[model samples]
Target: MTAIDILGIDIAKNVFQLHGADRRGRPVFKRRVMRDQLLGVLSGIEPCTIAIEACTGAFCWARKFEELGHRVKIVSPQYVKPFVRGQKNDGNDAEAICTAVRQPHIPLVPKRTKEQQDIQALHRARQRLVNHRTATICQIRGLLLDRGIAFGKSITKARRMVPDILSDMNNELSEMARDAIAELWDLFCNLDRRIISFDKKIEAVFRASPTCQRIAKIKGVGPKTATAIVAAIGDGREFRDGRHLAAWLGLVPRQHSSGDKRVMLSISKRGSQHLRTLLVHGARAVVRTAPNKDDQMNVWVNDLRERRGFNRATVAVANKNARIIRAVLRTGEPYRAAI
Candidate 1:
């Protein structure tokens, strides 16, 4: 009870490990409590800074702790790993969290509000469905290929060709094989429908959010990218600047350097891959169409594409767009493209 300044909780499904430290980082107490008893235990202690690893239930717990007037710092698991002493147990993990939270330089994970989490959940669900749909398409193609039938890779082509192939008796497809492909085709259609439904929901979310609309004004950013960036980092305040946001999105290049030699590799690819992908895909579209536009952004994109090639140009546009997004969010101003 030596005026605990920071408390770390290694959270799990059932048991919870707690480590309390004073302002000077000295351990005050260590204990283990059940899930149901967690609140009761914390309610007795004076409100202090609580540290937890960013994992499955960390955000929910952070919200709960904040309600109890305790400041919560959620550090990424990788950042906390270096601070762990001895073997990796619940107690040691808790101590590691406590130590990591005390470090002023370590970047903390942004605390997401309930609405942001819901948006992310929607994105995750849609991504999964998309993956399933892709798999189904590939499966359909592979099945047909085995029977010496070949068609274009386009999803539309596959949908039109498959039924014709199944109906024709001149092909090598057996009845059982046709039945299996039919089942998979049905599954693909179902998944496609589900994905469309999710798309509508995302559209609704984008239409409702003014922040999403403002950022979407950027040439490369669509409603999807705008919603995703907002969902990931509310007003972009957590990041120091737009490059910080780009780096968080893994748009920044990785570096390996010593002495006077500096070697930069591909993008670090950190943070959310989903958001990064959306940004890059949107940027690619913009880059592709840059040749037709006379805006400042398009001119830069066209010149970069000619010099660095298409892929590099696309990534460069993504980085630039991320910075623009951060500025828009920070200043509450609309993005204006230069003529």
Candidate 2:
């Protein structure tokens, strides 16, 4: 066997496809192996640079390969797509990964620790619960509206009206309808409890992580955003600079330029949607409250709001915050409020 320098594995639940190349990038071997025999096969081969797409179970496999003395690189699926040739299959995908890994400029996905995955899972759970709660509220409102009962947009208002409508027999609601609404109300409360529980868990994580604490010191960053950013990109080493971080979060404007003619559209809105949303929401809150403060950040925010309008200003602030967060993570320094 030629001395394999790079090996790419296209991983799946039950089967694995591998493509190997020599130091000169010539294909050495391509084969398929059962999941159970994967480790045994790799253990026999000389230790080499292994590349895999960053997907489910990728990190675990990367850690395993690293322990076996192989240098592992987890490449983003998008980055590997361009290298794939011919029909798409496990074998072709593996080959593409092998090719992508050898490219000097191809950005590799950072290997996440188990702790970071756990924190990310918690955030995902909380987001699901929140969506369920919103759906429940909308369902309740729609049910009441059918009976000619209307309430304010606020969830609290809808909740308050539910009890009143159930108690008053004067309304058009049937007993069965009342029972159904009551059940939904109960569900809403349960979701609230679960979301609160997730929040507490996130808070505990924030309390325990000094990195989270340092990031949270920024004006627009709270416990949730702080923990999430840390979990998503630890130490900010993957990014070249703060602007790159902002670009990763899709906060920067999208460009469609050719030659000297330049055109820019809205934000690219790529990358982590959850982090982008939290940062934008936090920025919105800061903008709403900035009028009352005289701090340097607030003054700048207010001026931007007046010049760019509120919505544009909000996104601008979010972009700024993302850069600040990246800087703080890279430097391991706490944020200092501008006077």
Candidate 3:
């Protein structure tokens, strides 16, 4: 095994592009390795700094290389984008990642643990099921409305009212439409079961995870929110402060400034959409029962509601909650609601 430095990997499902450079930033080794042979291939080489774009399945390989006595860093794909030369290809991307890694201050991604990935898988499944359920609900609504039947805004309400509406032989509805609703109802039921199963699995995970247990103390955070935040940010110490964490989560307002003028736009809409959604939803839930909430957040939200409308108020509270989450996680401190 020859010594090497700054090895970059462009990962795919089957084929992986590897670019190894010498100590002075000159290209030395270039080859493609099959997916199954990666560990053996890396094991054959001497330890050095490894760089790879942060994408799906990259964390596992990072862990593997770390075990192989190499320093591995995952570069954000967005940060690597500018480094790509005129044309984009696996080799170019690998080289770009290599170049990006040499910078001492490049922001690195937090690697997820196996347990964090498990929680993420649950979230992915639940999101899929929710999408399917919504589609089924929309179909039922459209079909029923075509036959002049009305329903409330929610799928659960549609599921409940459909049976009774179809139970009686109403002349307004045809047999074909009734059968369609029945099929749609069955589909909705299946999706509902899947969502409930996901809830149970996530709830069980929350119960068993000590880290998640501690995070759940934040007023707006629940089992899902806590687990998602834990998985997304890992230890949260990587961030310099809660403000940076909030910016990473894209909850902070976007800024554009000039010599004498400054403009603020909407949030960046980057980072984990699911995490942002969970935080916002949890914040709204807390705001719904604001008087009962015993924290500075409750007071803030209450004051905002009197000034801003409900929608803006919800997002404002969520942004604050994101900051609180980061601070708590970074300090390893439990949430102590401010009076």
Candidate 4:
């Protein structure tokens, strides 16, 4: 029997397909194993380099594989897709992963630690609650508009007006309509409470982590962005430099160039949308307040905004912030504000 030098696994909920190759890249075995038999089969094989596409549950499997004495590489699905032969299926994907792993200089995803996962989960839960709150507010506004009781777009304004609108006998609101509005108001209040609870939890996480605290010192990074950056990228050693970090976050412009001709488009927007949105929002806040401040960053932002317009300048600031964040994470240094 040939000794396997590399193994690729296409993981699914119930079934897993594997393709193993020898030192000379010759196929040693190709088979599908039930989820229950996965570890048992792998335990029988000698330690080898295992490659798997980074997806849902990929990190968990990576940790498990490492524990079994095999070095695991988590390749992004995009890189593996190029190596796929004909039609796509579990067998072809497993083969493509095997081929992609052997390619030189292909970047692999770092396995996230349990703590990082926990922090990210918290952020995701909070984001979901925020989305729900927005939907609830919109629903309330729509319902009020139907009855000709319009309130300002602001949620605070709506909250204040809701009680008066519900209780006032002057309005033509039906008893059933008033009751419905009251129930919706109660839901709105409940969502606000839940969101605040999540915010407190995130704040606690930021306070407890020294790295997050340091990150929060940067101009455009608040507790949420600070904790998010720390949770998303650990030490920031995975990338080549700060620019690479910005590019990874999709802050940099997309390129379409061939030969000497060059064309640049909007941002690639390839990575985490949540992180990019946070950074952009923070940058917009900085840009809005830049005119009143005399700091070096503010001056630069103001000049950029004047020359490139507000939207471009905001993105430029976000890109710069992303790079600064990378540098701070990489060097373990505190951010110094310029006078």
Candidate 5:
């Protein structure tokens, strides 16, 4: 009997599809197992490489398989998609994973530690609350507009004007309408409090982690950005270099070049959208203040802004910052300010 060189498991909520392949990539066994039997089946097989697609529970399964004395590779679903043959059933999906894992050049998602997951969860929860707050603000503004009471788009303006408008019984708002708007206002305030609470939690995490504090030393990177980067990439050892880290964050330009001609577009916008947003927002803040200072970094920022315009300059700063952050994490050295 040939040894199973690689086993790909297409995991779902209940059922799981397993595709085992030999050294030559020939299918040795194709089986389906329930959630209860998954570990039992894998435990019986001789230790080999297990390939799984990156998803909600992929990391947990990877850790389990690693404990079972088998190597695990979490391939991105996009990489597995192109390898699927014929129909798109569970067996085929599992086979596609096996095929995708065979290619050594394909980039693999790093297995995140439990601590990293916890930090990521905090960021996610905070972002969700922020989104809810924004929606609440918009609703409050829109309701006021319907009653012929309008204010500036700024959130501060909405917060102040809403209460004033609610108190003044001189406008078009009826009793029922006023009560409804008042409830939304309460919700807005509640969301604000929740978001603030999350902010403090993240700040605590940042303060406690020496690595996060070190990353925060980069001019544009604040406590939030530092924490987010650390949560997403841990110590950054998996990345080859700064450029590799930047590319992974989708800061690198998209290419459409063929043959001798070269065509470059905007940033690829891959990977974690939240991380990319934080980096870009921080860079934008830096770019906005660059004109006021004469520091070495600001000088370059000003020159770039003059040459490429404001938006491009902001992205360039973000890309540069991402690379710098990767170096800081990888080297474990303190970030030095440009004199």
Candidate 6:
């Protein structure tokens, strides 16, 4: 018996509608299943390709479906939205998903493992705390500056200055406002400590992974970027080459073509914005100190800097670094400074 080639699912928090087709491309099944019953139902079905939109809980469900002896593929919602037929309902969406899945070059999102989810959670929490701390400090500085006391712009100096600024008895702050300030200050301290702990934890993981160490050796690759890349691309076999890796990170140019006249602009900035930011920032750091190093990469960076100022050069370097990362991860090759 031939196996099913395409199956579309419209997923929801409580209920799901599944649309399945037989191997000959004829509609064979259309049914609604409760969330709890979904796995049991899928488990009984023979191994077949499953298609879904990449949305909340989709990845987790994909993992579960894969465990149940089915192949799962997730497509970007934007691409699937066009196929949505009249009246936007679960059945229509599922049918759209089926249509989208059959496109020859449908881009499939990689399914993340449980470990990747955990590490990503840590990264998200750390980022939120860092943002909160920044906002808290800004509020403190603004309140103090209202009374003629201003903090230095540097975060390090601000950290130390906050205590002395708040402890001043001469300040006109009301007792209630002062207490609130104190509480905020304490919260900032706690956020800082927790951030540091997470930093250490991430570093420990980075150092322990041979793949992470290989990536870290490359210039401009830091703990967050390295770990994210490692987690996102567990095995490089998923990508054909470095360019594909860069494209996945949305490093390639955007395309707008009509009647043979085409234009390409800045990077698409479509996927993994955080990862892209990390790579670009790290590239800036490398560009700033390129003169101190003597290597082909250094020369290349310097040449780019001379031709296209530092900012664009940084982006170029970051793009290249992203490619290098893909190569190293895919081939298990250690990084080497260019000749």
Give the top-scoring candidate (lDDT).
5
Separate clash counts for every candidate:
0, 0, 0, 0, 0, 0
Computed on alpha carbons, the lDDT of every model, listed in order, comes to 0.92, 0.92, 0.85, 0.90, 0.93, 0.85
Ranking by TM-score: 1, 5, 2, 4, 3, 6
Q: Candidate 6 on 1-339: residue-level lDDT in tens?
A: 345678899989999999887766667778899989998888878888999998889889998888888888888898899888899999989989988888877677777888877777778788889999999989877877776777787789988887887788787777887888889899889999999999988888788888888998999998888887877768666677888888888888889888889997878987888789889999999999998877888998999899989988988888899889988877887998768
After superposition, candidate 2 runs with Cα above 4 Å error: none
lDDT, model 1:
0.92
How many residue pairs of model 1 clash at the backbone? 0
Worst 10 residues of 1 by lDDT: 158-167
RMSD of each: 1.1, 1.3, 2.0, 1.6, 1.2, 2.1
Scored by lDDT, model 5 comes in at: 0.93
Off by over 4 Å in 6: 1-3, 171-174, 257-262
lDDT of 5 by residue, 25-128 (tens): 99998899999999999999999999999999998899999999999999889899999999999999999999999998888887888888899999999999
- What's each prediction's TM-score? 0.98, 0.97, 0.93, 0.95, 0.97, 0.93
lDDT of 1 by residue, 61-127 (tens): 9999989889998899989999999998999999999999899888888889999999999999999
TM-score of 3: 0.93
Off by over 4 Å in 4: none
Instruction: Assess the local accuracy of residue 162 in candidate 3 as a C-alpha lDDT between 0 and 100.
Output: 81
Candidate 3: stretches off by over 4 Å? 1-3, 291-295
Q: Residue 220 in model 3: shift from native, Å?
A: 1.2
Q: Considering summed lDDT, which 10 consecutive residues are worst modelled in model 2? A: 158-167
Q: Model 2 reaches what TM-score against the true structure?
A: 0.97
Error of 4 at 216 (Å): 0.7
